[model samples]
Target: MSTVSTPGEPQARSKPPIEAVPVRHPGRWVGVGIVAIFAAMLVHSLLTNPNWGWSLISEWIFAPPIVKGVGVTLLLTFLSMIIGLALGVLLAIMRLSPNPVMSGSAWVFVWAFRGTPVYVQLFLWANVIALYTTLSLGIPFGPEFFTFETKTLIPAFVAALLGLGLNEAAYMAEIVRAGILSVDEGQEEAATAVGMSRLQTLRHIVLPQAMRVIVPPTGNETISMLKTTSLVIAIPLTTELFFQASAVGNRLFQPFPMAILASIWYLALTSILMVGQFYIERYYAKGAMRELPPTPIQKWRRRLGRGGSND
Candidate 1:
């Protein structure tokens, strides 16, 4: 059918529809199948392995000594992280200071601590009484202040705490400094324009913004510190989980079971930490994001809803 338009009238034109395209991913199904098969095999081996000594593991799983060791390990991790965090904040502030001396001192501390192996440091701390028999308070090279024996002051637990906490402070300082740097320079300038001192600006504006960057790595460090607490054995801290479990194994001549027990506890603790980290990360992401990411539980529920709809 044909229609002629008048000279003053405009003609309406029809547009062509777009063609649809289907994407192909043939290897995706193959990769999924391979992963599924590997998972099945791993589960099968774990279930059927006879050398694991499941009976001994079950017996020692809730033993009083093991429970006590677990508690000590947790306590060390908590205390060390707290010390590290506080000391790290001071070091980070120092690193960012305008004074060259402050920055240099902070850098030297980080260099020394991070340069040496933590195990070696632990051993040295454990035997520090050899280098200095006594520790004292008051003026140095003057009238001696009240003195205390080094051995008396620094027992196995104290030595362990000192080694772990001091070493961790070095690493935490870098993490904190990076977090601080992630904040905008413009923000600092703006704060100064309003007559806020550097400390005040950091406390009120910068650190709060930096927390979003800080929290994730700090959570990772916390979990790592949990595992690193096992190294407290270098100080001969026999009350820690690794040492206690190994001691029990040596006594019973059943190393595998005791090792398994320790591993199970470590896994359980790390799993809890992972869940806590997830929630903490989500909380800190609030201001930076328009919408929050779905959690594992939410994703599962969404998948279930979709499946039900299909049915």
Candidate 2:
């Protein structure tokens, strides 16, 4: 069909077809560079390893009481962290509150906990002779039935629990605060526009978005809390991982090896937590990464490739 426009008639121009822009994957050089670095690291590790052909890994793993005591350490770490997480969230809210009294109370709690040596805090908790001298709540056998015995109430383990968990909460409150604040302000506004309450917006919208920023430090805190539980052995009532290991080491006169064994278990435990961190971070990032960020190389590749297309 030849439909040419006359000289006096207007000519119609065809619009350009929309094309799919291909994403620029990294070049072969990047993969080669990464492989070279990894190989160099592996070679260095092999060359510098203290034991080339032998291992005490089996002996380290099979130690009976040490293995069991690790369970206790894990228990203490997990329990305290659970408690600390709740306490931290509360304190974080209070610290960020508009009310002066609430914020001041939070500040005082953190100041006292972080100011004192944790060792001192543990000791004070273990010997918690009296939280308060007076029993203001009730009478022994009168109209008020409730009573708390000064001597019987505060046990050493309970004291240790309070000290470690509360101390951890103070540190974690700051971490939570920072994580919450790191969320974009626009998210809150959008959530509000959608008719969500402030609390609702914070819980469902802000916190979910802030997970990537929060997870790394929270993982570190978990590992730190695991090690910190060893301090509970000072109460002399219960045995933590280090306590059990140190006892056996002192008896056997293989103090160095036993201590090393304890450290190895701790590192293993922490490594597991680190792996969990990667998965958790990825889970949180899945939705966030829907709009992928263009890397620097991707930008340059696109710019360079555009030249070829234009030509």
Candidate 3:
């Protein structure tokens, strides 16, 4: 028999309550355990190993020559990046030029530098004496404005700087070009409508917006340039960090410890660079995103708050 409900009566709703279930990831736990065990074993080995010569590492870590080498490495990084970025800006502007000749020249220069191995270029520059007896600043086959003996003028240090700076310029050119291209075309049109000159438009409007895209990569390049300074060893630049480390290691017959010292210094330098990069990235990120991402410290504080609440 079926029963009919009155028109004014409300029907009772019957449904089970929905409950959330936590997902199980046994594989993640297993992976974490394995990683923990491996880390423990590695730490134990490093601590117990006599062959590591921790004392020698400590001694050489702050040695006068190594300290000087660190300074030299920093100087090279600063100078190379400055020169590279300057040249890169010019090349990028040329690449965007209306003139085919300007664009073509920029392209060729970038292609030549990027195509060759940096190490080989360094070596060639170091031994450039074999290619040219003297280098001249004046027009080719014309009146000599100035001339320099190749051997005296292009020492190992100069060769290293030239190679690193020039090679870096090729990469920076591409980076800068990408940044320039990221700007809105409409922005440039609006600037032009306002009677802004091309240079004025680029300087005042386009570049400021482009920096949001450009800065992160530029920071990366700076860090990379810092590490690339180590490769100046190919030029046999004796004052550089890696060369100094190797020389000291060979002399002491404790190459492993010296290597460890170098690694420590490199790690410290990279840590400092990473912090600078973080701040620079944050500064440029302003107004680009609706909400800024939390920094590490903020994340930690949030975690602490959550943990306290749970407790």
Give one clash count per candidate, in the order shown.
0, 0, 0
Measured against the true structure, the TM-scores of the candidates, in listed sequence, are 0.88, 0.70, 0.88
lDDT of 2 by residue, 181-282 (tens): 998899999999999998999899988877777777888899999899888866653667898888877886666667777888999999988877766776
Tell me the tens digit of each residue's lDDT in model 3 across 212-308. 8888888888888888888877877889888899899999888888888888888899889888888777887777888888889998899898886
Ranked candidates (lDDT, high to low): 1, 3, 2
Candidate number with the higher lDDT (1 or 2) = 1
Error of 1 at 174 (Å): 0.4
Could you give me the TM-score of model 2 versus the true structure? 0.70
- CA RMSD of all predictions: 5.0, 9.1, 5.3
lDDT of each: 0.91, 0.78, 0.88
Q: Write the per-residue lDDT of candidate 1 for residues 1-311, one digit (tens) a residue.
A: 44545566556643445556656777988998999999999889878987787888898988999999999999999899998999998999999999999999999999999999988989999999999999998787888768999999999999999999999999999989998999999999999999999889999989988888999999999999999999977888889898889899999999988998999999999999999999988988877999998999998899898886532
Give the TM-score comparing model 1 with the true structure, all chains together: 0.88
lDDT assessment of candidate 1: 0.91
Off by over 4 Å in 2: 1-61, 130-144, 150-152, 290-311
